[model samples]
Target: MAKQKTAFVCTECGSDYRKWQGQCNDCGTWNTLSEVRLGSSGGSGAASARSSALSGRRGGFAGAVPESRLLDDIDCEDVARFTSGTGEFDRVLGGGLVPGSAILVGGSPGAGKSTLLLQTLCHLARTMPCLYVTGEESLQQVAMRARRLGLPTDQLRLMSETHLESMLAALDEHRPRVVVIDSIQVVHSDEIASAPGSVSQVRECAAALTRFAKQSGTVLLLVGHVTKDGSLAGPKVLEHMIDCSILLEGSDDSRFRTLRGQKNRFGAVNELGIFAMTDGGLREVRNPSAIFLDRSDEVAAGSAVMVVWEGTRPLLVEIQALVDESQLGNPRRVAVGLEQNRLAMLLAVLHRHGGLQVGDQDVFANVVGGVKVLETSADLALLMAIVSSFRDRVLPRDMVIFGEVGLSGEIRPVPSGQERLAEAAKHGFRRALVPKANAPKHAIPGMQVIPVGKLGEALDALEQ
Candidate 1:
């Protein structure tokens, strides 16, 4: 018998190697290489025939030749999209789900990844043919959850299978307009001689399903498992094969979940969808700004509010900072839902420019409502919050602040500044301290626009 083919593959970057190594040469990650079996060189004739038939190729170079055309020759018409019966889900998908698109949704266990998809597919089944294929759960289990969630069970089709060939056969028989595989990790292909969730199995199964979706114009929704590090648990190549990649994130303590698009070919990747996990199911949070800004009645010293632009809309989030006397020689600088490096740099800027020394204090920063602030627009608000904590003074409760503080203490403008200010004003913010360039020419009604150009100027405005 011929020797079975084997190759070492890197789980981090999907780099292939002939032999096992301690570290991946491509991504520099240690202990991520795993052996993948590629089947025997001298397989049975039946297996070879099955492989060839599944690939739609009878023999070598037997397929029709393709012709290349100029890019201008292709149609430029917009692709049609169908709603998934969830506005937040649709918003994260750029607007709506496109026909023939392959979408991957990944999250931690109990993060409601399956629940969200079930609700969507159930609603869509009323209008169009939809299928729910589960390899991770029994059909009865899915039905029980659906019934508990109060979803309609009449039209939606359900299947429980892990074999890739059998799933494809069922797809051929059903010809559904929408199909969801409640997870890609458990599905295995017979062509690959490996257990399910292996790199080869995941790559092959996802590729085949994506190809079928493209050919049949079916909306393919794939649920994926996340690693302990909160990343998708599979070969990195799987993300490249899909049209969109979305991650559902929620902490155990919080009742809210956030859906964010990491990659999208049809829409913007920066869009965010917020959902509130209820007893019935995942309900969409239409006005996320209100929920995130749900602060207590009494204002505190170390808390301040800021406006952040999430994709097409503006979000109002609170920034909090605590400055306490350090007990150790080296002060601890911690940031939750914010970048630690940026926090340290902001502290340095405050000490140098504003003449406020916090080097001997332990500084902790947090964004309210578990919202991660990745933009520099939170700089001014963070600095103000820090100063408020240091001085033990409470900022105006109706005030909003957002601006980028540069290394030289100059405040910079962020994108969609006018809209951000308007959003804050709409939310009953009376005063605004923003970059001078971002200040609106006309005064906003029921709002005081306080534009500051320098860090010192902002500090002076806070005192007044």
Candidate 2:
């Protein structure tokens, strides 16, 4: 009989312990320690055999040792990427998908995650054999959708079964260049002894697929559903198993879907792909600045353009604010698409540092086009918008502002200001409001760069 040994593992962080504990030391979670089987019922010889088998069937013990030694001496060459048809996908992938890479694409429901993957696979399958295995949708449903999308289905295959072993067998026999699992939550592993979508099953199924992808040199894309809180559902280990992770998010109206890279071993993490949903499919927005800047022929008050940086791309965005006298005991402060805490801090700075009395005013601030503005480069624009609304004065045409505002009511220079100015210049912005310290720092011609030291200077400049 094999020796029986037990251990405790935290289900949250995968922390291990020798004995059962009340709480996990890593995450400080209560009651997360669960019994884990270390060894069972006297199988030392079998364990050795299984280890030998994993090391790949040794013709004999001597052969096994030689094979393992040979593996250590072998040097691997870097694999080249398989170019997908979509430029945005290729860019996010740092060119294109690599053979043997396991990719996890996660998103909210109806965020067009499936549509994007389907479109890419459709193009890939026209030349090479590809398989899509789904447990959520039926065969007829996928076929109908594919037909509507005008997908070339000569080499594309679909399977509705989700059993891991059967799926592996199909991959082995079919030898497909690409395999996509519609979702990992719906797949189950009998060895796990847990329901599908549970922590155990998700990890098990994903690990199996990842192993298969690496060994076969096949590209595997797994679609993962997000929880209500916008987190990928499954064990954290699933993320560690995959080579890349892409997150898809959209606004409430679902007009725009942004694909941001959460993890990419081959590229920068901050790179984003913008797409607008259309009747045909999601169309890539090449120039993102045009979508966020809404300017009329006539100059308008309460609207200011800011040069914001998202990753390496610089975009000009419009900010609008409205100030109204409050009748209630507490003024209603609403900030849409911008951080509420940041807005509150800015309001306090405007009052204490800029000599603006907004305590009795209801201020409503919004970043146009439903884009989240996290960079401090947008502060100058927001301040301009609020001041313009307060004075009911229109800002000059073809003017943009981007500078970080300090609590001392001073404008501070922002990083990548020169790059932002160049992008704004490319978009026909003739004038830019920046920090006083940034004077002579940027060299973009065809634009007048005005440096402002304080909010008073900015307000005065706007008046002129």
Candidate 3:
């Protein structure tokens, strides 16, 4: 029998080596190298067969192109964007999908990643023909999901196959305008003798499909699986191969989903798309501040309003906190999505400088609407709410509090204070505890805007 051909492959970067190495040469990840069979023909045969025309007399290798020549400008309008049928999805992608762009969508199981894509295709197929390829589930499964979505279009075609070589051949024959792969994990290639979802197969399949999409000038949407820790699965090169990558995130309750762009060659990265989970599908939430506010007849203590900036948008969220005596040596400062150590530090700041007896308290904080807050503008809100909750006092229902409490007991003006106030007012907040520096030159009627320079002043106003 002919000897089997194999090589050591780095699971992180997909770099192949003849001998095992302690660390990946490409990504510098340690202990990621594993042995993988390159099949009977080896990878060289596969590479030659795959790119025979490019490596021909044209000199397909990159060594031929000068570094300066590689930096040439590309057409902007021509490479603009493609409409995905969902307005929010379009917004997050910087208006639309780029022509011939390969985008990866990753999320947890049942996080509505697949549903969102299928809905998008159904909308696009109304004008353009689309093909959906699935390797893990059958065509019937896709059909069932479509029916549940009340979308059964004739232009929407589905294929169930794990063999990427066969899938590529079919794609060449069909030539659809848009292509969507249900997932990349289960897809494999015969060129590499490895189990499906392994590093080699995933890298090979992704490279092949990415090449095909770019060459054919077709837009491809790939649904990827996220690891348990929430990182995108597959080789690191997998993220590099695509033109765009969007991460869909939400709480386990399925009440909301947030689409954030980590990489976007078509537009700006860090763009955000918010969606509310409903029985129908993911509906984009345009003004999240309104949805997050809870206006009632009465105000309660230990409650405060905060502002957080997500990408380019500023949103107002309610912060609720409770404080009590600590039962253990280490007080518990628990935060759902926010950093726990940050909360502990804030508490310490309150005790040391703000004249708060919270050293022995078991304090907890929550950012409403199930979204995480990374901004410290909510610091004052958190402090006030915790104190109120401990005193069992009711805060004014129409009052909104937001500022950064300094160690010297001064109230620091938050960045984008005007915008935050506008959002709070739009949400029907009448009273606001704002930073003294952020106070407008001329006061507007109807709402009471109280500007304070110190945390003690704000506390006195709250007491009144």
- What TM-scores do the predictions have? 0.94, 0.86, 0.85
290-334: candidate 3 lDDT, tens digit per residue? 777754446666777777766667777788887778899988888
Query: What value of lDDT does candidate 2 attain over all alpha carbons?
Result: 0.81
Give me the candidate number with maximum TM-score.
Answer: 1
Q: Please report, in order, the local distance difference test score of every candidate based on alpha carbons.
A: 0.92, 0.81, 0.80
Q: Higher-TM-score candidate among 2 and 3?
A: 2
For 1-464, candidate 1 gives per-residue lDDT tens digits of 77788888888888899999999988999999888776677657568889878987753211233567999999999899988999999999998999999999999999999999999999999999999999989999999999999999999999999999999999999999999998899999888888899898998899889988987889999999998989899888899889999999999999999999999999987789999999999999999999988999987899999998887788999999999999999999999999999999999999999999999999999999999888899999999999999999999999999999999999999999889989998899999999999999998999999999999999999999
Q: Model 2: per-residue lDDT, tens digit, 1-464?
A: 55666666666687778988798889999987766444344567688888978987654311223434576687776668888788777777767899888999999989988888887788899888898898899988888877787777667788897788888999999988888899888997665555787665777688888888877889999999998888887656678879899988897676888787878887777567788988767778888889887567777688888988776678788888998889989988899878888888888888887778888988999988777777788888888888888878888768989898888889999888778888888989999899987666646789999999997788778867
TM-score of 2: 0.86
Identify the candidate with maximal lDDT.
1
Error of 3 at 223 (Å): 1.1
Candidate 3 has a TM-score of 0.85
Winner on lDDT between 1 and 3 is 1
Q: How many clashes in each candidate?
A: 0, 5, 5
